[model samples]
Structures are given as C-alpha cells and as structure tokens.
Target: MGQGRLPARLGLACCLLLLLLGGSGGLGSRGMPRGPWEEEQGPVAEGGPWGRARYEAVKKHLRAVGALSKQYWQYLACKVWQEGCEEEEEEEEEKESSPSPGLEADLNEQLHGQHLAKEVVVRAVQGFLQSPQPQKALVLSFHGWSGTGKNFVARMLASHLYRHGLKSKCVRVFISLFHFPYHKYVDSYKAQLKKQISETVQLCKQSLFIFDEAEKLHFSLLDAIKPFMGRYDNKGQVDYRRSIFLFLSNLGGNTINEVALDFWRAGRAREEISMEFLEQRLRLELLEPAENSYAHSHLLEENLIDFFVPFLPLEYHHVKLCARDAFLARGLPYTEAALDEVARMMVFVPKEEKLFSAQGCKSVSQRINYFLP
Candidate 1:
C-alpha cells in the first residue's frame, strides 16, 4: 500500500511530536529563550564621532547577528511545528509567561567583544544542532598556551545558543582541557573520550566535536579518526554533512624555533612543520584506507591518539581571516590604518621572537577598543 499523505497541520503536529519525544529527555529544565546574544539597549557607543561610528557599526553587527538567531528559531519551529503533538500548545503556553533564567557573566554586557570567537563557535554549533544530517560535526579548539579560552568557549557557546531557543535536546556542547599524556588511571582518557563521542553521536545527529588543545591529543587517539572525518554512510550514500570538526590550535605552536626544534630533534626531518600530522592521523583513525597502505603499516607510521578527530587543525591565519569577515559582517569596520595593523598582526610570530601574537578575535577586539574612541 502507498504511504498515507499527512495533511499540512498533521505534518506540523508530527514535527512537534518528534522534537518533544525524540530528544525531550535532554532538554534543559531552564529551557532556551530567543536572541541569546543580542546586546541589551542595542549596541552602545563610547561617544564622539569615532564612538558614534563604532556604535553604529556595533548596532549593524548586532542586527545581523540577531537576524541569524531569529532565522534559526523560525527554521527550527517550522521543522517541529508541523509535527507538534497536541500538548505542544499547552507546553508553549505554559512557557510564554515564564521569565528566563538569570544571565551568565559572559552573556552580560561587560564581556562584549571579548567573546567574539565564542559567538562564532556557538552559531556554528547551533547550525550543527539544526542540521538535517544524521551525524553532527565535531569541533576541536586549542587555546593559547596556558590560555583559558577552553572552558570559556564551551560555556559561552552553550549559554549563547540557549538564549537563541536551543535547549540540550537540540544541541549538545562540551569543552574540556587536555588531560592526556598523563591521566590518573589507565584507560581513563580513552574511555572518557570514546564515551563523550558516543554520547554526542547518540544525543544529536549533527555532532560538534572540539579539542581545545588538539595538538596535545595522544598519538594513538589521533590515528583513529581519519576514517570518520570525511563524508561516509553505512548504506553507501556518501554523507559528509553529518559532522563539523574544528581544531583551534595555534598552528605555529609556542615558537617556530621551538616547534621546529622539537621536530628537528625527533629526526622527523622537515624544513617546515605542517598541521598535516594531525590531518593524517585523523584519516588513519577514522577513514578505511590511506593511499591503500596496509593497516599495520599506516598505524605504525602514524601517531597514536586517545580520541577520534581531535579538531582538524586549520592555520591561525585562516581562522583569523574567517573571524575578521565574521566580525565585519557584524558591523565592525577596519580603517586603512586599522586594516594595515590587522594585516601585520595576523602574521604568525613565535612566542620568543614576537612581542605580539595577533590573538585573532581577541587581539582585533583590543585594537578596536583603542582605536574606536
């Protein structure tokens, strides 16, 4: 018999039902609100011509960001609205008057541009949550040496998404430090890593997997994710959209000299260091084949990792460039002098050889603070 056609109303009802029943267990009790990160009182200006311009820019960016948030909510509602169960109306009505939970410090005004990267990360995360693909993308972020952006990004992203109407049911965001190379107990690292991936895969189809200090993941674990990184499907339909893997490494570790020296000392003869090691390890671990090399041979040559696909490493320059565009879209402008300064700043500088490390969004933000007013 042919499948029964669902009426428009019935279809919307079903969507709601699936949303409520499919992932309700994980829905945060506090629930998500709309416009998670739109600045209150809109965008503020410090005053004067420069300040006024900056204010306008901030407002423009805020509007762009806000629009994206609204689009996301509507998209989600449309997807689940049709499938909504009978009780959805009642549940929504109950929530209508409910005051939102208290704001997080990061969500508050003080932090502002300090959290740009977090904002980018969260939006990407929300995108993954609403994705149609079965396997979500994983994000891996690496902070500056001994830097604190690890938990900050995770917490901020979650809070930001929550404000935009994505509860735990729709999105799962986790960020943790690197405890590898030395764990209190044997197999603890691997076990926890594997369990986290499993949970992410089960809870949300489009997973956002991140490794803060991706470079620090164990060699064995690195070897395991190559197969899982690219598009694949059990039924052989070639599905690559399921997962998002982000590795936020300082591509040029501590100092070029130091990084090169370490590689040099290891007898890993190469004039330049490449993020390729991390990439190769991912392919070996997750992908089925590597240039048709033997399984043992590939494993022997590759590094062992504790987890699969610990954030595919992208150059700091590339990340910053992308972030700059994102920031500009949000209404921030770079004056000629400012642009020149940014171009120079974006260049990679070793810790020792450099007085500055174009700290991507953070650095640009500081520059804005100084130049704006």
Candidate 2:
C-alpha cells in the first residue's frame, strides 16, 4: 500500500475500535444497547444510540397511535410505507362515494306512492354513476308539494352514497331561507357558494349538494353554480362530472296535483300517470314563471339540469301507509282502525273527491300524538 493511504485507513480502523470499546460492546449488563422504554425512563446518556425502534416507540406514545382505530392505523402505516395504500384507499372511497346498490330497494320500501320519483331517481343516478367520464354533473330537480318525499329521498340518496350520510363532509344541504335568507346578501352568498362548491369538489371527487327550497334561491346564487355544473373539465382543474346536485322545490305542486287528480277522476291508477304526462307540464310550469325565478337561471336556460323528477301528491292510502311506518318506527302498537283515524285526521283536497292528502303526510308523525295515552 502507498504510505499516505495506509496511515488514513489505519486511522479510520482505530476510530471504529475506539467507538466499539467506548460504547456498547457485544452484550454485557452495562455495555448492552438500551431499549425504547429504557431510554425514556432511565437517565439520559446524551450521545447514546437512538435506533428506529426507539423513534417508533416515541411516535406511538407522543401521537397516541394506540388510541387510533385499526383502519386509521392501517392507513397511517400504509401512508408511510406506501405498500398497497393506493388500492385500499381507492376501494374505501368507492364504497363511501358510490351510490348504494340497495337504493332501488330503499326507494321501494321507505318511499310510498310517487312511482315516477322512485324509477327516475334510481335509474338516473345509476346511469350517471356508471358513466366512465360523464359530460357534466348529474342535475336532478325534484318538483312537488311538501311532505311528498323530496327531502326524504334526498336524505336517502346522501345516506346511501356516503358513509356519514347528510353529515358527510362530501355532502352539503343548503336551505334557501336558512342558509341565505336575505336578498340583499346575494353578492356575498354567491361568492361563499362558489368557494364552498370548489373546496368541496376538491376534497371529494364524488360529492352531493342538495339545495332545499331551491325555487327561492336568488338568481345570482344559481348563476354562481353555473360554472361548476357546466361541461368544463380542465386537465388539472376541479372535475365536477362525478358529482351530483339535487334541487328540491314545491314550485310545480299545483300542476302535478292537477294531473294526479285528473287521473283519479278518470279511474286511472297513480302509477299509470306516466312521466310523459307530467314531465312536459312540469318543465313548462317551471320555465314559464316570473323573471328572476328558477326558470330564468342559467341552470334551466342552458338545459344543464339532466332530469326533472316530479313527486305526485300523496293519497289517503299513502298517508295511512306513512302513519303505519311512523307507528312501527316508534315501536308503538296500532290497529288498522287507528291508522285510518290518523289518516282521516289529515286534511284532504278538492273538497269533493277528498282524494289526496293536502299536507301529504307532512305532520303524520307528530299527529300520532293524538292517539298517545
């Protein structure tokens, strides 16, 4: 070896021997390497060894990793190691974000009457979600009277689509009067609404936004939503194609009720009141309204709304069914006679046929207080 290199190599070897000798050697009581707990509990040897295990232990204690759920801990581990985390995360998101396969069954069981709503909502949602790359977000405008299952069906959709239902961060419900009461704050509401939509879509790819009393929403607020609902998917921008926006309104209740009454008067089944019969009329009714209304908004003018789902007014039989459900839900025992009493207590319309319930089972549950002893 060269004289200069020989001395440098010898110096490194000597340093290694010195550290081994000065620190822990092969296993003796004092020379043995310390464990995680011992390092924390025992007196500090400032320049001592701190291995991966000790750091991991410190992380566990400091982060309260033990208190986390198994799924969360698995996620944390997967996040750090990145072994199959993408697949697991995607799978979990799909389960949480996608509409429930049981939605049809839920509609059948929970929702009474309104065959049009049941069929349209289920078919439209399923078809929209199945599309690989949808052109625009699924826009469903539900038109009907109060207690006609608009809000109920909205809740059902949210519950089925997300793990946390209406409470999900990915889901938002804006009641026009509650969220934005004053017409004076329209400008501020528009900005806030747009920001909320952008942030929500960024956080969750498949989000659900339900606008209750949608008919009362200011024209500016609806215009604010135009950009998000329009077919505009940039390369690295917020893609709203996978999202769903639902508008619940009682704007066309009269037209829908008239048709239902006409069908009843002609001895036709409510089921036979076809979508063709009501959809055209409902669309016209909503479109031919006053200026600055839902019809005048960009959403309708551009025809961005995919489907106009109409909820038919509930019948006395339907109201009775609702009472039955309420009774069952409350675990209260009731007879068919009791159900009829509750149904009859609700006000019916047309004054002569008294065919449909005016309130449409709106207060059927609270009305149960009548029979309580």
Candidate 3:
C-alpha cells in the first residue's frame, strides 16, 4: 500500500510540469520576452487592442500616397488636352462670326434694276444690325410681277447673312409650287410648317425663313405664322427676334407697276416716289378681294409684316443693264452694241408708248446668248 501511494504522487508531479511547459509554449508563440533595453525603451505591445490599431495606421498611409499620385497624373493630362481643345473651338467661332466680303460683292453685282429696293434693303439690314436686342423678327414682304428680282434679292440676303449662304441648314426655303402644291392638303401643310419653324428656331435663333410665291400660300398657313411674328421678351418661350422672314409674292404687282409708271410719266425722279405713296395702293390691292388675287389673307389686315418692298417694272435701260451683268457673269466680252441689241429684241407693252419691258429681265439670260458673239 505504501509503494502504490508513492507512484501516484510521482504521476501527479509530472502532470503539473507538463501543464507549465504548455503555458510557456503559448506565450512564446505570441512573442519573445522583452530584453532589458527594450523594457527600458518601452516594448511595443502585440496581440491585443494595439495590433488592430497598427494595421489601420499602415493602410491609411498607403491610401493617402495613392490618392495624391492619381490627382497629379490627372492634372497633367488635363493641361495637355484641354488647352488644344479650347484653342480649336475659339478659332472656329471666329470664322463663323466674321462676315464674308465675297457675298456682299455678289449681291451688289446681281441685283441691278431697282435702286429704291436696294436702298430699302440696305437700311433694313442696318436696322437689324444696330439693334442691341430686337423685340420682333424682321418681316419683309416683296411684291412685284414674276422675274422682278424678288427671289434674287431674297437669295442675296440669305447668302450675305449666313455662313453657308443659301445652302446653310439654318436657312430654309419653301416654295408654294413644291412644298404646298395641293390646296386641299392645307391641314397637313400647316402642321408641317409649324413643326419645321419650331424645330428650326429651337436649334438656332438666327434662322431664316423664305416663302416663295407667298401669294398662293393658303390663308390658314399665314395665320399659323402669327405666333412667330409676335414680340418676344426674356420671359417668353424663345427669343426668335433675331430671325428673318421674307415673303415673295405677286399679289400687288399691277398696283406697284401703275404707281411706278405714273411717276415715270410725270417726269418725276424715281426717288420721289415715296414708300408711303406706294403703300396705300399696295395695301388696298393686297387686302381687298379681287377677281384673281390672294388678298383675302389676314396677314395684311393684322399688319404683321414690317416692310412692303415694291419692286418697280424694269425699263429698257434696266434690261440692258441686266444683259450686261449676265454677259459679265458668263465671262463674255463687254460691248455696248450687244447690250443695246438685246434690249431692242425684247418686247415692250403698250405698242404706242413702249415704256417698259413686258417680261422685265425675266428672259435676259435666255436672250443674252442670242446677241453673244
């Protein structure tokens, strides 16, 4: 019994020694004991709340360096690319803003027979340019017989004002013969016209609208344009006052010719025939219902138009000028005899008086080749 108790005591002592070694191994796995110098300097704590704190400090340092490097590279790239882009944009704007000398010269050359019309046009354009901000769009109505340079003047205006001239996307031309050929399709034409005007103005405020053969345009269609002709303010939908509207019509041709002829017969200077004198008769003929006139439209009654430019009947000398211009355009030699011969060939109305060219310069281009040698 004494021997068995001795063996049990020895076993107990061995178990206690194994437990002490296991605790020592766990402490060694975490870290070695601090030396004398490390203890004096204060040992860095490990495997406690301080471990997570050290990891976070290293992560924050890396993020700051990375962000600074990224910002520096982005700034360098912007300096290189943005400068070139801005320069190109500025150059393009300058080119678009400057007026073309060639266009102005061409307009002055082509439109020959009407001094009054030219003066009116120049003043109107000057007014448009001088205005700091226009409240209403410039509406010009050209009334004359066919082939009286009405269309020619309109095209000239478009070419001079726009960068791409008549071909510009901002310039839109609608012919009654083409766009609104059928009178029965008035509703469709009205909707299309309104949509086009709205879309065009929305895209560009300086857009131009030309309505050729405006006399034949449906009255309802003219009514649709009333909104665009109104005074525009900052509070309005859009300020389309910078736009131009040109209406070419033959509605008051006879009245305009009669007034011009009277002036000529009275031996008065063409300049003496004031616009006011012509305006009364013209307004009467255009607003009154005649046998075969488009004067029934309320566009006249509402007085929406800004100007009524009357193109006078081209005389014999005027036709001669047109022939000379046509010859010059074709690079042909200039000759007084050639011009005189062409003018003589043209038929004039009133067999006794023979005052004006019946067809004006309408056939000048066609008749020019006959005398060209």
Candidate 4:
C-alpha cells in the first residue's frame, strides 16, 4: 500500500526542484541548458568573453545544484521510504554489550520519582555484563505499586540491551494472574515454565526472562526456575550466567510507601531514604510463609536474586511532570492548568492530606484524550 507513495513523493520533489530553479524571469527548458551553449556556440573559441563567463558561471551553479540535489534526494528518500537508515539499527546492535549509559540516561529522563531504580539497575546490569565469569544469572526484583514505573524501567533495560527490546525473541515476559491462575495446574505450570526458560536460554546466548506480579507466582513454579539460576552451571548444559531475570511485583509497595511517609513525617529529605532502609523491610515481607508465594521461593532461600530494586511511590509534582511528558508525547498543546487538571484526576492517598498519587501515573496517558481537540 505504501509503495505507491514513493514515486509520488519523488515526482513531487522533482516538480518542486524544477520550480525552485525556474523562478520569475528564470531559466526554463532550452533557455539555460545543463552545459555551456553547445549548438549555438559550438566551442569555447567561437564564444566571446561574455559567453565564456556565462558558461563558467552556469557550470559553477550546476555543480553547486548537483551537490545539493544529491543531498536533497538522499534526505527525501530516507524520510519518505526509510531506506539507507541502518545507522540507528547498527548503533542499537552495538549498544547490546554496553548499555548502561543509555539505560541510565533513559531512566533519568523518562522515569521520574524513582531515585534508587535509576541508580542501581543500570549499575547492576553493567557490572553483570562486564563480569567475565558470573556465578549466576543477574536477577533484579522490582517491588512497587502499580504505575510506579517498574514495568517502564524493565522496558528501558530491555530497549537498551536488545535491538527489538521486549519484542525480541530473546526476551520473555510472564505475567502472574494471566499466565498461571490455577493452583490445580501448578505441576504443569512448573514443567512449562522450565521448558520455556530452557528453550529461550538455549536459543539465545543471552536472554531476559521477566516474571510480572512475581509475588503471586506459585512457589513451585518459582522453584522450577532455580536450576537455571544456580550458582554453578551444570556440566554440558545450557549456560545461563549471561542471562538476566527481572521479578516485578507489588509485594513491598506498601512498605516502601510507609518508609517514604516516615521520611516525610520526620522532615527528612526523600533522597535520604536509603536502599538499606527498604531492603530489610521488603525481605521480611517476602520471607513470611503465610501470605504469598515469596516465602517458599528457592531464589530467596539461596540468595540467588542479586538485587531488590524498589520503585517508590509518586508525588504530586512527579505526576505533573509525567502529565507534561504525556502531553508532549501526544503532541497536544497544554498549559500549566491542563497539567494540573490531568494530575488532579488521579486519586491520591492519605485522604486527609492527599500526599501521594494512589494509582501513580498509570492511566495518565489515557486520560489525556479527554482534553483532545
């Protein structure tokens, strides 16, 4: 369907170029030929000084126009047809091995209100990739509330590391409530989970396996992945040390919020809330045997999960910033009042004070349609 547009675009470009060259009282067909007066003045010796100068001048203008036409054609072709644009693809392929800088920059620019995530995730992945002989796969457990940018950060990691990002064959995402809801099929779930992981690691030298709503994952199913993340690779087996595993969940979201609230109440800077403060609290919650699946997980027991990255709750200004970004992304004209309106639409928690966004920036993008023209 789009093929027809290419020739049309080139034809339009030609017409525009002709019009540009042929302006008011300007040269037309046969008026100023491509080269010097060929038939009218057969040779340079037959032409006068004025004719010679005109020939040289025309030659100079033609040379300049030729260079410009070549450049314009290249630009037009790349824009309309998207041909010869492999530089971006090549750069993406190159960043596969060294992606910390890009990931860090993306986290800083795109993801807001998560200091620890921006700091730690890039560092951990960079270190793991640089390690010549890693003992096990790099595992990052992302804990936060919905819309706190856990999935966003995961995507940033994937985009920087893989050319196709999450869509890459090497990257796999498993959601809890959707993928494995029935406890009756836990046995089969374990088998399928192992098979998928094995196949992915075997197919790609490096792989990314993401388990969303990880806290709700069946303990048995979670245990099924233990072999792949073992400290030592089994002899003559698919090696997984080069892979990365991400566990995204809301398991410790409340704990993280409580800690943030405590810092606020204490009049301490939010930046002062360190990783140690929340890691211990999150670990305690995960270890409890009564509530969820983290308790019986082998990943925790063996201390195989390398990092427990926390996604802090978002604030009012952070939501505004997110809304501003949304407006820019959607190419909609906005004002401070529009941004305020979008942020006000969100339900905030601690009802009396309305300190934090209850849903973070989850639906902010969809809400922008209300203000669309």
The candidate that achieves the highest TM-score relative to the unseen native structure: 2
| Alpha carbon lDDT of each predicted model | 0.42, 0.84, 0.74, 0.83
TM-score of 1: 0.34
- How far out, in Å, is residue 293 in model 2? 1.8
Q: Which candidate number has the best lDDT?
A: 2
Residues 24-62, candidate 1: write the lDDT tens digits: 123343553323222233333223234455467657756
Question: What is the clash tally of candidate 3?
Answer: 0
Q: What is candidate 4's lDDT per residue for 27-52, written digit by digit as tens?
A: 43668523343334445546445465
In model 4, state the lDDT of residue 264. 89
lDDT of 3 by residue, 24-106 (tens): 21233247532222222223453333355555754664576466555544443344333344444345434543344454456
Q: How accurate is candidate 3 locally (lDDT)?
A: 0.74
Q: Judged by TM-score relative to the true structure, which candidate is superior, 3 or 4? A: 4
Stronger candidate by lDDT (1 vs 2): 2
lDDT of each residue in 179-236, candidate 2, tens digit only: 9999998999998998998888877889999999998899888988887788865864
Candidate 2 error regions (>4 Å): 1-95, 233-236
Residue 123 in candidate 1, Cα distance off native in Å: 20
Which of 1 and 2 is ahead in TM-score?
A: 2
Residue 83, candidate 3: C-alpha displacement in angstroms: 21
